[model samples]
Target: MRGFRPGLVPTLVVAVLVPLMVCLGFWQLSRGEYKRVLMQQYAERRVAPPMDSTELAQTTDPAFRVVELQGHFDVEHSILLDNRQHDGQVGVELLQPFLDRATGAWLLVNRGWLPWPDRRTPPVFSTPEQPVSVQAWVYVAPGATFQLHADPVAAPWPRLVTAIEPDKLWAELGRSGFSYELRQQGGPGAYRTDWPVVSMGPEKHLGYAVQWFAMAAALFGLFLYLGWHNAGRPHGKHHESNQHV
Candidate 1:
Protein backbone atom coordinates (compact mmCIF):
# COMPACT_ATOMS: atom_id res chain seq x y z
CA MET A 1 0.00 0.00 0.00
CA ARG A 2 2.93 2.34 0.69
CA GLY A 3 4.30 2.43 -2.89
CA PHE A 4 1.09 1.57 -4.80
CA ARG A 5 -1.54 4.22 -5.59
CA PRO A 6 -4.19 3.81 -8.27
CA GLY A 7 -5.65 7.00 -9.78
CA LEU A 8 -9.40 7.60 -9.35
CA VAL A 9 -10.12 7.31 -13.09
CA PRO A 10 -8.19 4.06 -13.51
CA THR A 11 -9.81 2.63 -10.35
CA LEU A 12 -13.25 3.56 -11.63
CA VAL A 13 -12.60 2.03 -15.05
CA VAL A 14 -11.28 -1.18 -13.52
CA ALA A 15 -14.18 -1.31 -11.09
CA VAL A 16 -16.66 -1.32 -14.00
CA LEU A 17 -14.69 -3.35 -16.56
CA VAL A 18 -13.33 -6.15 -14.35
CA PRO A 19 -16.72 -7.13 -12.95
CA LEU A 20 -18.34 -6.91 -16.39
CA MET A 21 -15.67 -9.18 -17.88
CA VAL A 22 -15.98 -11.67 -15.00
CA CYS A 23 -19.76 -11.75 -15.34
CA LEU A 24 -19.46 -12.33 -19.08
CA GLY A 25 -17.06 -15.22 -18.39
CA PHE A 26 -19.53 -16.88 -16.04
CA TRP A 27 -22.42 -16.31 -18.46
CA GLN A 28 -20.49 -18.12 -21.19
CA LEU A 29 -19.84 -21.03 -18.79
CA SER A 30 -23.56 -21.33 -18.07
CA ARG A 31 -24.32 -21.30 -21.82
CA GLY A 32 -21.76 -24.08 -22.35
CA GLU A 33 -23.38 -26.20 -19.64
CA TYR A 34 -26.81 -25.61 -21.17
CA LYS A 35 -25.65 -26.70 -24.64
CA ARG A 36 -24.01 -29.81 -23.17
CA VAL A 37 -27.23 -30.85 -21.44
CA LEU A 38 -29.29 -30.10 -24.56
CA MET A 39 -27.06 -32.24 -26.79
CA GLN A 40 -27.20 -35.10 -24.28
CA GLN A 41 -31.00 -35.01 -24.26
CA TYR A 42 -31.09 -34.92 -28.05
CA ALA A 43 -28.77 -37.94 -28.32
CA GLU A 44 -30.80 -39.95 -25.79
CA ARG A 45 -34.18 -39.27 -27.34
CA ARG A 46 -32.96 -39.86 -30.91
CA VAL A 47 -31.85 -43.46 -30.31
CA ALA A 48 -34.92 -44.60 -28.34
CA PRO A 49 -37.63 -46.69 -30.09
CA PRO A 50 -39.87 -44.68 -32.39
CA MET A 51 -43.31 -43.89 -31.01
CA ASP A 52 -46.65 -43.83 -32.81
CA SER A 53 -48.74 -40.67 -33.27
CA THR A 54 -51.05 -41.58 -30.35
CA GLU A 55 -48.11 -42.19 -28.03
CA LEU A 56 -46.36 -39.08 -29.33
CA ALA A 57 -49.44 -36.91 -28.58
CA GLN A 58 -49.38 -38.01 -24.93
CA THR A 59 -45.71 -37.21 -24.33
CA THR A 60 -45.16 -33.81 -22.66
CA ASP A 61 -41.50 -33.25 -23.47
CA PRO A 62 -40.79 -34.46 -27.01
CA ALA A 63 -37.77 -32.62 -28.33
CA PHE A 64 -36.00 -35.29 -30.34
CA ARG A 65 -38.28 -38.26 -29.85
CA VAL A 66 -38.55 -40.37 -33.01
CA VAL A 67 -42.03 -41.16 -34.29
CA GLU A 68 -43.22 -43.65 -36.91
CA LEU A 69 -45.44 -41.86 -39.42
CA GLN A 70 -47.86 -43.54 -41.84
CA GLY A 71 -48.88 -40.54 -43.91
CA HIS A 72 -48.87 -38.94 -47.34
CA PHE A 73 -47.47 -35.46 -48.03
CA ASP A 74 -49.69 -32.60 -49.28
CA VAL A 75 -47.81 -31.26 -52.22
CA GLU A 76 -50.19 -28.40 -52.96
CA HIS A 77 -49.48 -26.27 -49.85
CA SER A 78 -45.69 -26.37 -49.61
CA ILE A 79 -43.64 -23.94 -47.48
CA LEU A 80 -40.13 -23.03 -48.45
CA LEU A 81 -38.10 -21.83 -45.44
CA ASP A 82 -35.57 -19.41 -46.86
CA ASN A 83 -31.91 -18.70 -45.96
CA ARG A 84 -30.86 -22.28 -45.25
CA GLN A 85 -27.27 -23.17 -46.12
CA HIS A 86 -25.71 -26.60 -46.68
CA ASP A 87 -22.03 -27.20 -47.52
CA GLY A 88 -21.62 -23.50 -48.43
CA GLN A 89 -24.55 -23.64 -50.85
CA VAL A 90 -27.62 -21.48 -50.35
CA GLY A 91 -30.93 -23.37 -50.11
CA VAL A 92 -34.36 -23.62 -48.57
CA GLU A 93 -36.09 -26.29 -46.48
CA LEU A 94 -39.30 -27.75 -47.88
CA LEU A 95 -42.12 -28.37 -45.40
CA GLN A 96 -45.43 -30.01 -46.32
CA PRO A 97 -48.52 -31.07 -44.46
CA PHE A 98 -48.77 -34.81 -43.83
CA LEU A 99 -51.92 -36.61 -42.74
CA ASP A 100 -51.17 -39.58 -40.47
CA ARG A 101 -53.62 -42.28 -41.51
CA ALA A 102 -53.45 -44.33 -38.32
CA THR A 103 -54.26 -41.56 -35.86
CA GLY A 104 -56.06 -39.27 -38.35
CA ALA A 105 -53.74 -36.50 -37.19
CA TRP A 106 -52.11 -34.04 -39.55
CA LEU A 107 -48.58 -32.76 -38.93
CA LEU A 108 -46.15 -30.39 -40.58
CA VAL A 109 -43.11 -32.32 -41.79
CA ASN A 110 -39.79 -30.82 -42.91
CA ARG A 111 -38.75 -33.08 -45.79
CA GLY A 112 -35.33 -31.40 -46.04
CA TRP A 113 -33.04 -28.93 -47.77
CA LEU A 114 -32.82 -28.28 -51.52
CA PRO A 115 -30.40 -26.06 -53.39
CA TRP A 116 -32.10 -22.92 -54.75
CA PRO A 117 -29.30 -21.46 -56.83
CA ASP A 118 -31.50 -19.14 -58.89
CA ARG A 119 -34.16 -17.02 -57.24
CA ARG A 120 -35.91 -16.50 -60.55
CA THR A 121 -37.32 -20.06 -60.36
CA PRO A 122 -38.84 -21.97 -57.44
CA PRO A 123 -36.80 -24.62 -55.62
CA VAL A 124 -37.26 -28.09 -57.22
CA PHE A 125 -38.75 -30.78 -54.90
CA SER A 126 -41.10 -33.76 -55.08
CA THR A 127 -43.88 -35.26 -52.93
CA PRO A 128 -45.13 -38.82 -52.58
CA GLU A 129 -48.73 -39.28 -53.68
CA GLN A 130 -49.21 -42.68 -52.05
CA PRO A 131 -49.32 -43.22 -48.27
CA VAL A 132 -45.83 -44.11 -47.10
CA SER A 133 -44.25 -45.17 -43.85
CA VAL A 134 -41.52 -42.83 -42.61
CA GLN A 135 -39.64 -42.21 -39.38
CA ALA A 136 -39.04 -38.69 -38.09
CA TRP A 137 -38.11 -36.84 -34.92
CA VAL A 138 -39.89 -33.98 -33.20
CA TYR A 139 -37.90 -30.78 -33.71
CA VAL A 140 -38.29 -28.11 -31.03
CA ALA A 141 -36.21 -25.00 -31.45
CA PRO A 142 -33.96 -24.45 -28.41
CA GLY A 143 -34.76 -20.78 -27.69
CA ALA A 144 -37.14 -18.07 -28.80
CA THR A 145 -38.46 -18.34 -32.33
CA PHE A 146 -36.44 -16.27 -34.80
CA GLN A 147 -37.46 -14.94 -38.18
CA LEU A 148 -35.30 -12.80 -40.40
CA HIS A 149 -38.35 -11.52 -42.24
CA ALA A 150 -42.05 -12.08 -41.71
CA ASP A 151 -43.86 -14.40 -44.09
CA PRO A 152 -46.58 -12.70 -46.11
CA VAL A 153 -50.06 -13.30 -44.70
CA ALA A 154 -51.57 -14.02 -48.13
CA ALA A 155 -48.67 -15.94 -49.66
CA PRO A 156 -49.89 -18.42 -52.24
CA TRP A 157 -49.33 -22.18 -52.38
CA PRO A 158 -45.64 -23.11 -52.32
CA ARG A 159 -45.11 -20.14 -50.00
CA LEU A 160 -41.58 -18.84 -49.61
CA VAL A 161 -40.82 -17.67 -46.07
CA THR A 162 -38.02 -17.04 -43.58
CA ALA A 163 -39.54 -18.99 -40.65
CA ILE A 164 -41.88 -21.86 -39.88
CA GLU A 165 -44.86 -21.49 -37.57
CA PRO A 166 -46.70 -24.82 -37.75
CA ASP A 167 -49.56 -23.70 -35.54
CA LYS A 168 -50.23 -20.71 -37.78
CA LEU A 169 -49.93 -22.85 -40.87
CA TRP A 170 -52.40 -25.36 -39.45
CA ALA A 171 -54.80 -22.57 -38.51
CA GLU A 172 -54.61 -21.10 -42.00
CA LEU A 173 -55.11 -24.47 -43.65
CA GLY A 174 -58.10 -25.19 -41.33
CA ARG A 175 -56.68 -28.51 -40.16
CA SER A 176 -56.42 -29.99 -36.67
CA GLY A 177 -52.78 -31.06 -36.51
CA PHE A 178 -49.76 -31.47 -34.28
CA SER A 179 -48.23 -28.11 -33.36
CA TYR A 180 -44.56 -29.12 -33.54
CA GLU A 181 -42.65 -29.75 -36.76
CA LEU A 182 -41.39 -33.27 -37.54
CA ARG A 183 -37.99 -33.47 -39.26
CA GLN A 184 -37.97 -36.52 -41.51
CA GLN A 185 -35.21 -39.08 -41.17
CA GLY A 186 -33.54 -40.65 -44.22
CA GLY A 187 -36.18 -42.64 -46.15
CA PRO A 188 -38.44 -42.28 -49.20
CA GLY A 189 -39.56 -38.75 -48.26
CA ALA A 190 -36.34 -37.16 -47.07
CA TYR A 191 -33.68 -34.95 -48.66
CA ARG A 192 -30.40 -34.04 -46.92
CA THR A 193 -31.72 -34.91 -43.47
CA ASP A 194 -28.36 -34.32 -41.77
CA TRP A 195 -29.14 -31.64 -39.18
CA PRO A 196 -26.84 -30.13 -36.57
CA VAL A 197 -28.41 -30.18 -33.12
CA VAL A 198 -26.77 -26.91 -32.09
CA SER A 199 -25.16 -24.27 -34.29
CA MET A 200 -22.39 -23.41 -31.79
CA GLY A 201 -21.26 -26.30 -29.57
CA PRO A 202 -20.24 -26.27 -25.88
CA GLU A 203 -16.56 -26.20 -26.77
CA LYS A 204 -17.00 -22.87 -28.55
CA HIS A 205 -18.73 -21.35 -25.54
CA LEU A 206 -16.00 -22.69 -23.22
CA GLY A 207 -13.35 -21.14 -25.42
CA TYR A 208 -15.18 -17.77 -25.29
CA ALA A 209 -15.36 -18.06 -21.47
CA VAL A 210 -11.58 -18.56 -21.31
CA GLN A 211 -11.00 -15.51 -23.49
CA TRP A 212 -13.18 -13.28 -21.29
CA PHE A 213 -11.58 -14.51 -18.05
CA ALA A 214 -8.08 -14.08 -19.48
CA MET A 215 -8.88 -10.52 -20.53
CA ALA A 216 -10.16 -9.72 -17.04
CA ALA A 217 -6.99 -11.10 -15.46
CA ALA A 218 -4.77 -9.16 -17.85
CA LEU A 219 -6.68 -5.92 -17.12
CA PHE A 220 -6.41 -6.39 -13.34
CA GLY A 221 -2.70 -7.16 -13.66
CA LEU A 222 -2.15 -4.01 -15.72
CA PHE A 223 -4.10 -1.99 -13.17
CA LEU A 224 -1.84 -3.21 -10.39
CA TYR A 225 1.33 -2.48 -12.38
CA LEU A 226 0.14 1.04 -13.28
CA GLY A 227 -0.75 1.78 -9.66
CA TRP A 228 2.69 0.78 -8.43
CA HIS A 229 4.54 2.51 -11.27
CA ASN A 230 2.58 5.80 -10.80
CA ALA A 231 3.14 5.80 -7.01
CA GLY A 232 6.92 5.31 -7.44
CA ARG A 233 7.31 8.41 -9.69
CA PRO A 234 8.79 11.57 -8.07
CA HIS A 235 6.47 14.52 -7.25
CA GLY A 236 6.66 17.71 -9.34
CA LYS A 237 8.38 19.74 -6.54
CA HIS A 238 10.93 17.02 -5.90
CA HIS A 239 11.71 16.68 -9.61
CA GLU A 240 12.12 20.48 -10.01
CA SER A 241 14.47 20.70 -6.96
CA ASN A 242 16.54 17.79 -8.18
CA GLN A 243 16.88 19.32 -11.64
CA HIS A 244 17.98 22.70 -10.21
CA VAL A 245 20.57 21.05 -7.93
Candidate 2:
Protein backbone atom coordinates (compact mmCIF):
# COMPACT_ATOMS: atom_id res chain seq x y z
CA MET A 1 0.00 0.00 0.00
CA ARG A 2 1.19 3.55 -0.81
CA GLY A 3 0.08 4.66 2.68
CA PHE A 4 2.04 2.80 5.32
CA ARG A 5 1.78 2.62 9.14
CA PRO A 6 4.09 4.92 11.13
CA GLY A 7 6.59 2.30 12.39
CA LEU A 8 5.90 -0.69 10.12
CA VAL A 9 8.89 -0.62 7.72
CA PRO A 10 11.33 0.54 10.41
CA THR A 11 10.22 -2.36 12.61
CA LEU A 12 10.74 -4.86 9.82
CA VAL A 13 14.15 -3.45 8.86
CA VAL A 14 15.21 -3.39 12.50
CA ALA A 15 14.29 -7.06 13.02
CA VAL A 16 16.72 -8.13 10.29
CA LEU A 17 19.44 -5.64 11.22
CA VAL A 18 19.58 -6.79 14.84
CA PRO A 19 20.94 -10.22 13.97
CA LEU A 20 23.32 -8.75 11.41
CA MET A 21 24.65 -6.37 14.06
CA VAL A 22 25.04 -9.07 16.71
CA CYS A 23 27.09 -11.14 14.29
CA LEU A 24 29.42 -8.21 13.63
CA GLY A 25 29.83 -7.46 17.34
CA PHE A 26 30.79 -11.06 18.09
CA TRP A 27 33.27 -11.00 15.22
CA GLN A 28 35.10 -8.08 16.86
CA LEU A 29 35.05 -9.89 20.19
CA SER A 30 36.85 -12.78 18.50
CA ARG A 31 39.38 -10.39 16.98
CA GLY A 32 40.14 -8.87 20.39
CA GLU A 33 40.93 -12.32 21.75
CA TYR A 34 43.31 -12.93 18.86
CA LYS A 35 45.24 -9.75 19.66
CA ARG A 36 45.40 -10.70 23.35
CA VAL A 37 46.88 -14.12 22.62
CA LEU A 38 49.50 -12.68 20.31
CA MET A 39 50.47 -10.13 22.97
CA GLN A 40 50.83 -12.79 25.62
CA GLN A 41 53.06 -14.84 23.37
CA TYR A 42 55.15 -11.78 22.70
CA ALA A 43 55.72 -11.28 26.44
CA GLU A 44 56.42 -14.96 27.09
CA ARG A 45 58.85 -15.36 24.20
CA ARG A 46 61.08 -12.50 25.36
CA VAL A 47 63.53 -14.97 26.91
CA ALA A 48 63.96 -16.98 23.72
CA PRO A 49 66.84 -16.51 21.31
CA PRO A 50 66.84 -13.29 19.35
CA MET A 51 66.24 -13.58 15.62
CA ASP A 52 68.67 -12.11 13.12
CA SER A 53 66.87 -8.89 12.14
CA THR A 54 67.54 -9.31 8.39
CA GLU A 55 65.88 -12.75 8.46
CA LEU A 56 62.76 -11.71 10.35
CA ALA A 57 59.54 -10.93 8.47
CA GLN A 58 56.76 -8.74 9.84
CA THR A 59 55.16 -10.93 12.47
CA THR A 60 52.91 -10.73 15.59
CA ASP A 61 54.52 -13.80 17.22
CA PRO A 62 56.84 -13.27 20.20
CA ALA A 63 59.48 -15.75 19.04
CA PHE A 64 61.72 -13.06 17.53
CA ARG A 65 62.71 -10.89 20.52
CA VAL A 66 65.23 -8.95 22.65
CA VAL A 67 68.93 -9.23 21.88
CA GLU A 68 72.29 -8.87 23.64
CA LEU A 69 75.08 -7.51 21.43
CA GLN A 70 78.52 -7.04 22.99
CA GLY A 71 80.75 -4.29 21.70
CA HIS A 72 81.91 -0.75 22.41
CA PHE A 73 79.40 2.11 22.25
CA ASP A 74 80.06 4.44 19.34
CA VAL A 75 78.89 7.60 21.12
CA GLU A 76 80.18 9.91 18.39
CA HIS A 77 77.36 8.76 16.12
CA SER A 78 74.98 8.52 19.10
CA ILE A 79 71.97 10.83 18.95
CA LEU A 80 68.65 11.49 20.69
CA LEU A 81 65.12 11.46 19.32
CA ASP A 82 63.88 15.03 19.62
CA ASN A 83 60.73 16.27 21.46
CA ARG A 84 60.28 12.98 23.35
CA GLN A 85 58.64 13.81 26.70
CA HIS A 86 57.79 11.46 29.57
CA ASP A 87 55.93 12.03 32.90
CA GLY A 88 55.38 15.69 32.05
CA GLN A 89 59.16 16.17 31.83
CA VAL A 90 60.85 17.20 28.57
CA GLY A 91 63.70 14.82 27.66
CA VAL A 92 65.43 12.63 25.05
CA GLU A 93 66.80 9.08 25.02
CA LEU A 94 70.35 8.28 23.97
CA LEU A 95 70.67 6.23 20.74
CA GLN A 96 74.14 4.83 20.18
CA PRO A 97 75.40 2.29 17.66
CA PHE A 98 77.12 -0.75 19.24
CA LEU A 99 79.57 -2.39 16.87
CA ASP A 100 80.58 -6.01 17.51
CA ARG A 101 84.36 -6.14 17.31
CA ALA A 102 84.31 -9.89 16.51
CA THR A 103 81.55 -10.37 13.83
CA GLY A 104 81.39 -6.71 12.82
CA ALA A 105 77.60 -6.90 13.24
CA TRP A 106 76.17 -3.73 14.82
CA LEU A 107 73.07 -2.64 16.76
CA LEU A 108 71.68 0.88 17.01
CA VAL A 109 71.09 1.22 20.75
CA ASN A 110 68.49 3.47 22.42
CA ARG A 111 70.67 3.37 25.51
CA GLY A 112 68.56 5.37 28.00
CA TRP A 113 66.65 8.53 28.98
CA LEU A 114 67.60 12.16 29.76
CA PRO A 115 65.92 15.36 30.89
CA TRP A 116 65.86 18.62 28.95
CA PRO A 117 65.12 22.18 30.10
CA ASP A 118 63.10 23.47 27.13
CA ARG A 119 62.13 22.55 23.55
CA ARG A 120 64.83 25.00 22.43
CA THR A 121 67.29 23.63 24.96
CA PRO A 122 69.45 20.75 23.63
CA PRO A 123 70.04 17.99 26.26
CA VAL A 124 73.50 17.36 27.74
CA PHE A 125 75.26 13.96 27.63
CA SER A 126 78.37 12.16 29.01
CA THR A 127 78.55 8.59 27.47
CA PRO A 128 81.74 6.65 28.23
CA GLU A 129 84.19 5.53 25.51
CA GLN A 130 85.13 2.04 26.92
CA PRO A 131 83.58 -1.00 25.20
CA VAL A 132 80.00 -1.56 26.59
CA SER A 133 77.47 -4.35 26.03
CA VAL A 134 73.93 -3.40 24.91
CA GLN A 135 70.68 -5.32 25.35
CA ALA A 136 67.72 -4.28 23.25
CA TRP A 137 64.60 -5.37 21.36
CA VAL A 138 64.09 -5.11 17.61
CA TYR A 139 61.61 -2.40 16.56
CA VAL A 140 60.65 -1.34 13.06
CA ALA A 141 60.76 2.38 12.44
CA PRO A 142 57.38 4.10 12.33
CA GLY A 143 56.14 6.29 9.46
CA ALA A 144 57.25 9.88 8.90
CA THR A 145 55.66 12.60 11.00
CA PHE A 146 55.83 16.39 10.97
CA GLN A 147 57.15 18.57 13.89
CA LEU A 148 59.75 15.96 14.89
CA HIS A 149 63.12 16.60 13.25
CA ALA A 150 63.76 13.07 11.86
CA ASP A 151 66.19 13.52 8.98
CA PRO A 152 67.66 10.41 7.35
CA VAL A 153 69.93 11.99 4.72
CA ALA A 154 72.20 13.95 7.08
CA ALA A 155 75.07 12.84 9.32
CA PRO A 156 74.22 10.58 12.32
CA TRP A 157 74.85 12.70 15.39
CA PRO A 158 73.75 16.28 16.40
CA ARG A 159 71.81 16.10 13.10
CA LEU A 160 68.10 15.72 14.00
CA VAL A 161 66.69 12.35 12.79
CA THR A 162 62.93 12.02 12.27
CA ALA A 163 62.83 8.43 11.03
CA ILE A 164 64.90 5.27 11.48
CA GLU A 165 66.43 4.30 8.15
CA PRO A 166 68.45 1.14 8.72
CA ASP A 167 69.66 1.29 5.12
CA LYS A 168 70.93 4.84 5.59
CA LEU A 169 72.62 4.01 8.91
CA TRP A 170 74.19 0.90 7.38
CA ALA A 171 75.48 3.03 4.50
CA GLU A 172 76.74 5.56 6.99
CA LEU A 173 78.67 2.72 8.64
CA GLY A 174 79.84 1.47 5.18
CA ARG A 175 78.15 -1.93 5.70
CA SER A 176 74.57 -3.14 6.16
CA GLY A 177 73.75 -5.07 9.34
CA PHE A 178 70.07 -5.30 10.34
CA SER A 179 66.68 -3.95 9.29
CA TYR A 180 65.13 -3.11 12.69
CA GLU A 181 66.03 -0.44 15.28
CA LEU A 182 67.42 -1.63 18.60
CA ARG A 183 65.32 -0.57 21.64
CA GLN A 184 67.91 -0.44 24.40
CA GLN A 185 67.25 -2.47 27.52
CA GLY A 186 68.68 -1.06 30.75
CA GLY A 187 72.35 -1.78 31.23
CA PRO A 188 75.11 0.45 32.67
CA GLY A 189 73.80 3.85 31.58
CA ALA A 190 71.91 6.64 33.37
CA TYR A 191 69.75 7.24 30.24
CA ARG A 192 66.01 6.63 30.66
CA THR A 193 64.08 3.99 28.67
CA ASP A 194 60.78 4.25 30.53
CA TRP A 195 57.89 3.54 28.14
CA PRO A 196 55.82 6.58 27.31
CA VAL A 197 52.17 6.66 28.36
CA VAL A 198 50.04 7.04 25.25
CA SER A 199 46.80 8.98 25.55
CA MET A 200 43.77 6.73 24.84
CA GLY A 201 41.93 8.91 22.32
CA PRO A 202 38.41 8.46 20.90
CA GLU A 203 39.71 6.73 17.77
CA LYS A 204 40.56 3.54 19.68
CA HIS A 205 38.89 0.26 18.60
CA LEU A 206 37.32 -0.67 21.96
CA GLY A 207 35.03 2.37 21.95
CA TYR A 208 33.77 1.54 18.46
CA ALA A 209 33.03 -2.05 19.49
CA VAL A 210 30.66 -0.85 22.22
CA GLN A 211 28.75 1.45 19.86
CA TRP A 212 28.23 -1.33 17.28
CA PHE A 213 26.91 -3.76 19.90
CA ALA A 214 24.36 -1.22 21.19
CA MET A 215 22.98 -0.70 17.70
CA ALA A 216 22.69 -4.46 17.20
CA ALA A 217 20.75 -4.90 20.42
CA ALA A 218 18.26 -2.15 19.51
CA LEU A 219 17.68 -3.75 16.09
CA PHE A 220 17.14 -7.22 17.55
CA GLY A 221 14.45 -5.98 19.94
CA LEU A 222 12.61 -4.10 17.20
CA PHE A 223 12.63 -7.09 14.86
CA LEU A 224 11.32 -9.46 17.58
CA TYR A 225 8.41 -7.11 18.26
CA LEU A 226 7.57 -6.85 14.55
CA GLY A 227 7.61 -10.61 14.07
CA TRP A 228 5.20 -11.05 16.96
CA HIS A 229 2.99 -8.15 15.81
CA ASN A 230 2.55 -9.69 12.34
CA ALA A 231 2.13 -13.25 13.65
CA GLY A 232 -0.47 -12.41 16.31
CA ARG A 233 -2.70 -10.18 14.14
CA PRO A 234 -6.17 -11.65 13.54
CA HIS A 235 -5.76 -14.47 10.98
CA GLY A 236 -6.26 -13.35 7.34
CA LYS A 237 -7.03 -9.83 8.63
CA HIS A 238 -3.20 -9.63 8.93
CA HIS A 239 -3.38 -8.25 5.34
CA GLU A 240 -1.73 -10.76 3.00
CA SER A 241 -1.11 -8.03 0.41
CA ASN A 242 0.93 -6.05 2.97
CA GLN A 243 3.74 -8.67 3.42
CA HIS A 244 7.04 -6.97 4.18
CA VAL A 245 9.55 -6.95 1.33
Give candidate 2's whole-model lDDT. 0.62
lDDT, candidates in the order shown? 0.91, 0.62
Compose the digit string of candidate 2's lDDT tens values, residues 1-245.
Answer: 22323256776677577767777777666656555554555566566776544333444532327765667877778777666667787777677777766567766667666887766766778776777666677654223346444465665465555455666777877865666566766776646765521222223445556778998876666566666665555556456656753
In model 2, what is the error at residue 102, expressed in angstroms? Answer: 3.6
| Cα error of candidate 1 at position 202, Å | 0.9
Best by TM-score: 1
Q: What is the lDDT of residue 3 in candidate 1?
A: 89
lDDT of 2 at 235: 54
